[model samples]
Target: MMAIFQPFFNIISETGRVVQFFFQMLDVWKRKSISRDLMFEQIWKVTVQSSATTALAGFFVGAIMTVQFTMEMKDFGALGYLGGLSTSGTIREVGPLLIAFMLAGKVGAFTSAELGTMRVTEQIDAIRCLGADPIQELVLPRFIAIVISSFFLLGLGLLLSIFGGMLLGKYFSGVNYEEYLRHIPTIVSLPSILSGLFKCFVFAVVLAVICTHRGYSTTGGAKGVGRSVVQTAVSTMVAIVIADWATSLLADIALKIFLRSR
Candidate 1:
């Protein structure tokens, strides 16, 4: 009877260990002297490496939206509003969300796999043996990098998407470039842009921290590393969706309160 329960007990013990490891990671911020080089490396890898994919996706999304909306507008004789509608929708929602999703698959997975490999190869252990803090060296820099990178990527994605939409509108929908540009400013609100930026920043931080933590905790060599990579991507994406909703709700409430006060 005791033998049967031993495996279950061991499973519970492992689960407890993982939970403890997560809390320990939360304490990483207390350390001073973050690694600037590592942060830059992370930014380059997460942001620059991801740029092409995000840009391509943004272009297609913008082009398709323009086409679809133009068709609808044609039916309603409101084709002139296509530029403003497409720009507003893309910048405010589609652009940021798409870029974040791409980063979760690309940067998030890469970060997890890189750290997971280090863990399996005992590189992280070597750092620990040298009396260096893994959290400060490994996690903090990547966290900051991803947060900054996300903002830049989101902004770039917005620009590319808007460009794609404008070009498509001009060529296919008979809308001129100047007319498209003229309406964009009116449609793009400061609050909406700020909200998107804020969301991207939060998304990036969550991705980096969670993925790094997952990799840092890997144990069983190659298999563990692989598992960490998959888990990191999945978890980061789920977190992004949840965070987006929460941010939107909070922003809406705050806006309402501010308007009432005004």
Candidate 2:
């Protein structure tokens, strides 16, 4: 009985810790204790590191989606709609989710390891001993940077995915660029675009919080840092998937309500 309940207790305890840490960061932000230079440096570093990879992943996602849609539509003589259908699917669901996963694996893991190292090496403790708040001097900048960079990178990926789908549609299905892009406006609405961006924002926050929390709590030295990285990856991925489902459901409901009102 105790063993079965242990996992549930662990989940609750972890959730509490994450929430507490998030509020601490929030309090720092509220007090304007964040260092602009540190925040900007982190933002630039992460953005530069992840840009190419994120763009490549986004482009391929669109291309693969186009290919799948093309195959399905070709059987029905509907290849002309490939661009719109694929673009709609990618932008609304696949693009943000998969791009976010890529960001988690790269950005999340690196941040966790870096923080974990500092924690185990007693750098964080040294800062505290010297009368500096590590949260303000360290974690806060990273937290803000990850949120900003992740948002921009995810959006960039979504943009590239459109071009990707168009290029692939033109070559693979013999669909002209104009025809391929023609139905996008008809299929992908403003609300859908907003929903995707919202999901990106939510995923970014989730990724930032998990990585920082895991890193800050790391205890066992090198092995502990490794464990934290693994935990960050697994937890962030699971959280993102849950967030994606919840956002999709809410977006659909909101759209329905809006349509009824109009």
Candidate 3:
């Protein structure tokens, strides 16, 4: 029975190691050898390269949500509120959740595979032998890049998702640009926007921890690297869902408190 839960135990252990690695790297930031170059490279690799996928998915998700919601509202002759409804859904739930899922598959897997290979080849060990901190030189740059890029990606994705819904409303639902967007202010307030961004930041941290931990701990050479990649994807996706739910719950409670005060 312990064997059945072994992987879960390993995950917990990895999470701890990743946390420790983060703090150790944090202490080394004043060192000259800490490479800003690597961070930029990772930005290009993790964020810029993945932008197309995020935007495309956002557009389609928004359009589909608009279509579905508009159709349903039309049944009761209240379709005029379609823009507000769709945008609220996109920003509050679909946009953050969907973008995180896509990024987990793209960026998360790449991180794990790359780091896992380095571990298996003993390249990480070689760097350590030279009195270098591999986690600072290696993991920190990727970690920073992932978090910053995820922030930008999630925001852009929300915009694209709203744009997609607007387009659908304009061409198919006869909403026109102005009418389609008129309700945005009413439905999506400051707290609502902040909540979505909060979800994104939390997801970024979760993704970084899971991917790096799995990658750095990889075993068994080529096969282990492959396993780490799969584990990164699965664990990240699962974490994203859980983080999304938790953040959403918190947002709801906060919103309620604010409303009561007002």
> How many pairs collide in each candidate, listed in order?
0, 0, 0
Q: Clashing pairs in model 3?
A: none
In terms of lDDT, model 1 sits at: 0.80
Best by TM-score: 2
Q: Cα deviation in Å at residue 198, candidate 2?
A: 0.7
Q: Model 2 over residues 1-262: C-alpha lDDT tens digits?
A: 7999998899889989999999988987788667789999999998988999989988999889988898889999988788778887877888778767987999899999999999999999999999998889988888889888877887788778888888888888889989988998898888888888888788888889999999988999999999999999999999899989998999899889888998
Report lDDT per candidate: 0.80, 0.88, 0.85
Instruction: Write down the RMSD of all candidates, one decimal each.
Output: 4.3, 1.4, 2.3
Backbone clash total, candidate 3:
0
Residue-level lDDT of model 3, residues 5-61, one tens digit each, is 998898788667867866665676556455888888898888787899999998888
Q: Where is model 3 poorest over a 10-residue stretch in terms of lDDT?
A: 25-34
Q: How do all the candidates rank in terms of TM-score, highest first?
A: 2, 3, 1
Q: How does model 2 fare in lDDT?
A: 0.88
Higher-TM-score candidate of 1 and 2: 2
TM-score, cand. 3: 0.90
